[model samples]
Structures are given as C-alpha cells and as structure tokens.
Target: MSETRTGIETNPFDRDHYDYSSWFFWVEASEEQKAEQLAQQEQFLRVRPDSSIGERCFISPLAAIQVETLTLGRSSYISGHAYLTGTLLTGPNCTINPFCVIRGNIRLGHSVRIGAHTSMLAFNHTITDPDLPVFKQPTSQRGITIGDDVWIGSHVMVLDGITIGDRAVVGAGSIVTKDVPAGAIVAGNPATVRKWRVPELAPPTAASVPSSGPVPSGGPVSSGGPVPSGDPALAEQLRAFDQMVREQAEEVLARSWDAATGRYVDAPGHAPSVRAHCDAIEVAAYLTGDVPSQLSREEHVAWLRGLQDPASGMIAELDASGHPGPRVTDLSVDDAHYHVLCVGYALEVLGSSLPHPIHAVDELGADGVIALLDSLPWRGSPWRSSNVADMLGTAVLWNTRAGTPHSAATAAGLFGWLHTHVDPRTGMWGADDPRSGRLETVNGFYRTARGSFAQFGLPLPHPERVVDTVLAHAQDARYFAADRQNACNVLDVAHPLWLAGRMSDYRQQEIRQVAARLLADALSHWRPGEGFAFAADSGTGRDPLAETPGLRGTEMWLAIVWYLADLLGVSRSLSYRPAGVHRPEPAGSLTSQ
Candidate 1:
C-alpha cells in the first residue's frame, strides 16, 4: 500500500494514488470556516433573543455540524443530523426531521413540517457556458418560502425560485420545479399534482336526486347524475346569451388586426394596438367555448407572427421601431429585457390557447429568451429597476412553464441581485449599479411601479426584516398623518405595505388604520365624471390627475381596494367563534372550506 500525504494508505495495485494532501487542506479549511461560522451563528441567535420556544422539540446532533444562522419557532422540533446553514426563518409550531440540508435564505410558515433527508436550497450557480467555471460566474440566491401547514415528505428537493402554497403537500423523493398551488398534492421528478386536496363534487342529498329520469344532454345534472326537473327555457336563454358574447368577442378580436392597420377604408379609427389585439384574443379563447372561436384562433396566430422581430428572434412591443410607437409606449424596441417579457406573455397566452401540446422551438424559444436576458449587462444599466424586475417576472412565469435549470438559475440571480439593492433601513429597492446614476432618487415614486416589483411572487428575501422595516416606517405617524400626500408612492410605501399585510400580524392593527385613512384621503380626491384622480398635494407631478379608466391611478386604486377587502374578510372570519370556544388551534391548521 502506498502511503498518502495524510498517512492514509492507497490501494497498492493502483498506478495513481489519490491526492490526500489537497483533501487534507480542504478538510482543514472547512474546519476553520466552521468555527468562524459558529461564532457568527451565535451572534444572530442573540439578536432574536426574544423569540419563543415550545416544549418537546428535537434538534438533531448533526444540526450543530455547521455553525450558521438558524432560527426556530415555538413548539417546533428539528430532528438530529440535519444540516442548516445560512439564514433560516421559521414560524410557530413547525417540525424539521433528520438528515436534511437547508441552505441559504429560507422562510417557513406556521406548522410546516419537513420529513427526513429533504434538501431545500435557495442558491444556485450559473452554468450556461461550459467554458467558464461555474464559480467564476455570478451566484444567485433567494429565500425558500414554504407556506403555512405545508408538509414536505422525505428526500424531497425544493430548489430556489419556488413557493409552496398554503396547505400544499409534497410526496417523498419528488423535485419541485414550480410553484405548487394551494391545497395541492404534488409528486414526481418535476412535481405535478397527483391529486387535489379538495376534489370537486356537487352536494349530495336524497331529495336532490331524481327517482328516475332520462338525462337530458343540455340540462343540469342532479346529485345522482340524472336530469333535474327544471325549466329548459331558462337554460336555453342563458346559453344563447353566452353564445352571443362569445361571438361578439370573437368578431372583435378577428377584426382587430385589420382595424389596427386601417386596411379597410370603411373601418372607424386606426387598428387596435398589438397589446389590445392580443388581449382580445386571449379573452375570446378562454371565454366559455367548446372549441376556440375561429376569430380567436386566427387573431392569436396573427398577433404572434406580427410581434416576432425576425431579425433578432425577440418580440417587439409594436410593429414599428423605437418606444412610443402608435400603440407601444416606454422602453426601446431593442430593449432585450422588455422584449423577453413580451415574448413570455405572448407564448403563455398562445400556449394556453392551443388545444394540444405544442413543441417549444428549442433553439429560439424560451431558451433563446433566457439567453438574451442573461446576455444583457444589467450590473450597471440605467433601466435596471423597472426593466430588470419585468424581465425577472417573465423569467419566473416562463421557468414555471418550461422547468429548465438555466431558467431557474436566472430567476434566482435576478432576485438575488434585487435583494442586495434593497435599502437596509427602509426595505425599498433602488436602481442597480451601472444604472444607479440614471435614477434621480434612490426610492422615488414612479407610475407602473407596483406590478413592476410586486409580480415577484410570495416569500421575498429577508421577509421578517422587510416587515420590520415597513412597520417601522409606517408607524411614524408623520408618514400616515392626514396631510401626508406621499401615500400614493406605491414603491416606497403602498406595495411594501400590501406585502407586509400578506405575511404576518406584526402590525396588523396599525396597518389597517393607516390603510383606512389613506382610502379616505383617496376618496376625497375622487371626481364624479373621472374614475379616480391623483391627489393634488402628491409631491410627484409624474402622475397627471385624469379620468382615463385604464391609467395608472385606476390600477393603483383597484389594487388598494382589493387589499382592503381581503384584509377585512380575513379579519371578519377570525372574529367568528362557536357559542363556547374550545382550545385555540394553530392558525396554520385552517384551510379554505
């Protein structure tokens, strides 16, 4: 036996011996880093000193192997031999089993349980070009968000850029590659719904079932799947009305292209914009039809062909070049990020419209879009905030469809890049470097800003920290005073406030009060003929007070209205109780009835 550098013996018959010296160096470095990491870990644990813990918790011995950031919730047990590194955020009453590897930026909702040996990683390396080493390329990381009451089975791997919705269950050994919808049970390599949590079924009752009747082809079916004794005239009338709307929508979509181009002299006004045409096609295709209406199909295909920029395989906002064309506004035609976003939207609409599976154009489809997105040097570009966020949102939607590893990595990178730029004190994002000079203010108000960043789905980076930041800013009565007109600054306040409301009850009462006050102020500015108007006192003059129904003011008002309604509904539900209430159950246990 040949003696190795570490005094370990190599197989005597082997011509080449293993490099034990290098291996020893790696081991030594790992040990030294582990010690330093432990010290840092202790520091973070102390920072959250007021956190509560529950009884009968089990933390594995292996969990102590790496001394990195780990936070545990009350009554939560972490099994032995699990490896947790980087920031781990857990809510009350959770369980994590043995031999799991959870690394980097993780947030777990209440009552979440991870079965044995699962891997949850929030960071990935770029590997598009084999010539360049993976490490040399940028590394991207995001927070892994597991919603309330989620049950992840043994040996499952949930990668970055995924959010497991509330009450979702993941089967053992499955790899989740997309957002698992709420109340779903997913399993498989790229996990898909094996079964729905709540199966769709009509209510059953003896009286509801017909004793004996021939099932009518176009009539309502009873509980026993027999035709019910109902007026056929009503059904016929409803069907006719539905058909009329479908036909009208189809006709509108079909004529959009010609109407937009002014090809027919008899047509009134210029042809509709590309976006308008595509939007109409989408509505027509999905609207109550056994087969896609002929007009919907023809218009959809025409829009797809027209949007394609043949020269670069990029989709253009308008047929003409440059921004602010006949229908297209903002962002240049050659803007890689915007083009990719438009392409993703177009493809998604097209994909949903098709009755059967369509083969993706391998070299020039999603892959090409990803390539163009990654190629753009966003590190120091002037349009990083709006443009990068848009591209990232599109990439998330595309990756959810395609499930490509590269797409996932790119999405994570974009989030990681955005996370770093978030103002530590205010939880607001500024323009990224290289483009930093272009932005007049770091976190200034801008129209079309809410959806721009809000499109990045649930479980944002350092969510708890973000929540704290927003609460801190919001509570400073100065920001919420009746005279304050900055409430319309969606990026700096409204969007973050909305996100915080979704996460936790940290400042639930305060947020509700502030939201109510803001709504009252907004209503004061509402004009009778105009849909909604921007406050005259609003410091930013970028948004013009207008009655245009589709303007930014209208969109922001709708979003605010939805947020308030959702919060009120949730509050009302929580207030209800039986005549005499039993012991309170964990919040996570509740699911949609």
Candidate 2:
C-alpha cells in the first residue's frame, strides 16, 4: 500500500506493467474522465527505480525523468515532456508544468505551481576569462529552494541558488536571480520584488509540504536525516525503500557467488576478481547476515590463501591454470596494494587472517619509510600517495596477529611523514588548484587519510578543516552531479565527511543535509533485487541497464549508504556499521598499540 494513495487504488505493480498513460491523469474535466480509475503500482513502474514516491503522484508517460534522486510528494503533478534530471525533492500537490527544464538540484514546496516553459538550472558555468569557451569552464551548484504555496508563472527562469519564499508569486517571463520574499509579486529580468501581498487578505496557511523532497530549511547546504521525512507517510515509504535495498544485498552476493572457486566473479562469464570477492564478503558481513554463498569455510579460506605471494606477502589473482602468476595487470583487482585492505579485511570478517606476513616493505625503519614517502607524488595525485598506507596498515594488522615488530616502526615513520606534509589550510595532502580544482586533492585526502590515519586509529591533525574541504567540494557541479557521480567519487566525498564527523561538529547540520541528499541519490541508482551498477544510465558510460550490477560499485555503495545514514544519526536503522573498506570505526592495530 502507498503511504498516501498509489496512482491506482490497487494493483500498481501488476505483472502486466500498468500503463502510466491509463492514469497519466484521470483528474481532468468530468465525463471525459471515464478512463480515470485509481491505479496501484510500484514506485519503479512510473518514476525512477529505488525511489520512495508518494501516492496519487501523476507523472506523464512522456516525462523525461533522468533525475537520479527524486521523491515526488503525495498528489504531485508533473506534466509531459518535463526534462527533470539531477536531484529534485518536492512537497505534495506540486505542479511541474510541461517543458519545465529542471536541469539539476531543486527543491519544491507543496501545492506549488510552475508554468510552462520554466527553466530551473541549479549550477552555473564559470566564465571568468573572455578567451575561454563556456563549455570548457567548470560549474558550481548552490541549488534552488521553493517554499510552500508558491506560484511560478510561464517562461520564468530560476537561476542557481535562488529561494522563493512561501506563498510567493513569480510573474510570467520573470528571471529569478535573487531571493523572492514571501507573499511578494516579482516580475522582470532579474525578478525583483514589486509589492508584498497583505497578510490579512492572504490565503489561509496551507498544510506544510511533507518533506517528500524537503529542502534544507535553513543553515548550511549539508544536514543529516533519512529521507526528508516531516510526514508519517514519508517515514513509512523510507522504511520500505530501505527494506528493498537490504534485500538486494542478498541478491548481489547470491548471483555473484562462485561455488567452484569459493569466490565471486564480476558476472557469470567474467573472470573471478580478488577485490570483488573481498568486497562481496565485506558487504555480506556488514549488511546481510549468512548470505548462503554455499562455499565451505575451508574452501573459501584455501582459495584466498592460494592467491598470496609468499615472497612479497601480498595477494594477487591466479592465472588460467589456477595458480598465482607474475603477469602484471593494470587493474585495481590486480593491484597488490589494494588487495591488502579489501582482501585483508575480507579475511578478517570471515574469521581468518592473511595467510602470510606482509613483507612488501618489511624491516623498514623511520628513515627508510620517510625516504620512500618523500619520493611519492604527494603534490600530484593524493590517491597515489595513499597507496602505501594500505601496505602499512596491512603490515600492522597482519603483524599484530603474527607477532612481528616491523609494523610499529613503519607505521610510526609513515605517520610522521603524513603529519609533516599535510597542508594545514585544506587539511589535505595538496592545496586546491584555486583556478579549476576538481576536488582531486580533497578526494585524495580521504583516500590517503583512510589508509594511514583512520586506519591505525590516529586522529587527523585538523579534522574540522577536512569537513570544510569535503563539503565545499560537494558544492561543485562538475564532480558531485548525477552525470559525474560514480561509486568512487561518491565514496570519496562520503568517507571524508563521515570520518571528520567522528572528530568535530563544525558543520554538523550541513553534513546531515548532505547525508539525506546522497542517501536518496545512492538509492536511486539501485536496481531492486539486482543491486547497483558502477554508474547509472546517465553515468560516464558504465550503464547498469545494459550490463550486470558491478561488485565494486554495489559493495562500496551499500557501505557508503551506511556511512550516509550514520551521518544522519540513523545508522542504527541500517542495523550494522560497515566493517569493509569504508568502516567507520578504526582498526585494532598492533602498530597503534
């Protein structure tokens, strides 16, 4: 049952795939409305999958809904050919007129009326230099928020960062560049206020829009909460959506499980991946319990141990003959260092340890490790610099279990280098590129910090600044938008904010808002019982519709969602904290001790 009203009174999810046109709109003029009957359908049939849409929401069959994260309020009306993409949250009874090009981040209040040919673009391109092409410039997102009982006229253009106050009236042909005052009438190029409506003559206050797609009421852009739920109906819908996501975790593991090799493959025909196997195991342990992979503990452990290189004490993939080979491959699964965390943690979750001590960089003292850390491309790609942290963290993890001394010295030396090199201003490995910084360094900061600082239970020297950089980077349209948000980038933004949350509340509410939006965004990409893809249809070429769900994306996103919920203080709702690559709690390391 829908929280309010399924477009249909019943059977919305008929195996027949109910025709949205049948209910595209039954609420028009009378006698002609004979075709009007209640339609009961699943949220996915009409809108995007993994959404929590309210009842009686009439979205035209022809609506081009590319919005990754959308939550339509009860009785919301979106007319045909409305190009809605990116992330949009709407309160109930909202009317999105035909040809409304809502290009990106936007929030709408209840009973809001948007006229035809209106355009709301949440990000603007940077055109600093006359010589530079506009296409080449970067875009920034401040998002647009519309208050309750708003009325926007036809041919209106709402630019990025505009807020239309409650009961506001935007005249046709107006261009809204500044904030619209409540009960005011605005018309003109820049959409300035002309006169305020008298309060006495104003319409009685309508019910507040139920936070179906609630905008950040006030405060920083980021805040935490599960599904903008100011209504009981929305709260119920959030629970259902979450239940569906949890069920997908089981399907993800079951489909990818390989009984023969006692591991998981990317898909049916794809070769087995070391990282995928570990990712699946971590996901299962953290989110889904006893997933029934059917591989005996001995069989699984043997397969894992077989991948280890005794000489290097690192794990690798087996060749066609089922034995570890020395062929260098340019894949993350083949990257021995990554396996240290993914594989090492996977083993821990399954009641085992790395079969051998990590001698990858063994016997290194303070000077030796310092010299190596100094040589890395710290200023270039922070991601590259973080690679050694995995080896070092793994050294501490495995050594503590195996009772070795090398981990302490190596960890101590690496910590010193990180502290000495970390940029105080951004609290990242490198400074922002002031001109066109694509959040590479900030993202790298998370990757690097995760490996060493967060890995060994060490606090970042400036955790507050880390939150600042991560939140600021999230406002940039180039990286955080729907088209650009892949599993890795989403993880990069999510983890740093989550890690910093443990240390400071500098922007706590801002972090919560980010948590709510991103939680909705990640769920939007979900494929129901099928799990997630590395990218959505709007993604950078990795389409889940054409291919099977990716293990890396599915696992990481399932974990990222936990982090998002944690930020919202609803992580207990997830029922478990991630113990895999994105674990919140620090590892119990011998080095730390």
Candidate 2 lands at a TM-score of 0.57
Q: What overall lDDT goes with each candidate model? A: 0.43, 0.63
lDDT of 1: 0.43
Indicate the worst ten consecutive residues by lDDT in candidate 1.
575-584
**Number of the top candidate by lDDT?**
2
Q: How close is every model to the real structure, measured as TM-score?
A: 0.39, 0.57
Give me the displacement of residue 402 in model 1, in angstroms: 3.1
Candidate 2's displacement at residue 478, Å, is: 1.6
Per-residue lDDT over 1-593 for candidate 1, one digit per residue giving the tens place of the 0 to 100 score: 02322343545653112121111222333344434434544554466332223332334333543423344555565655677765565655677776788876566767788988899987778587899988898655534667677799999999874667656789999998765655568899989777756333211232542221211111111111222333345334334433443335334333333533432111123333434433333333233211123443334444455554433334434433212233222223445444454333333333221111111222324445445445654444423444544544443433333333444444445555555555665344543333323231222312112222334333444444555555555544543554444424422454454444443344555655655555446444433322233232444454443322222232244334333322332211111110000001111221111
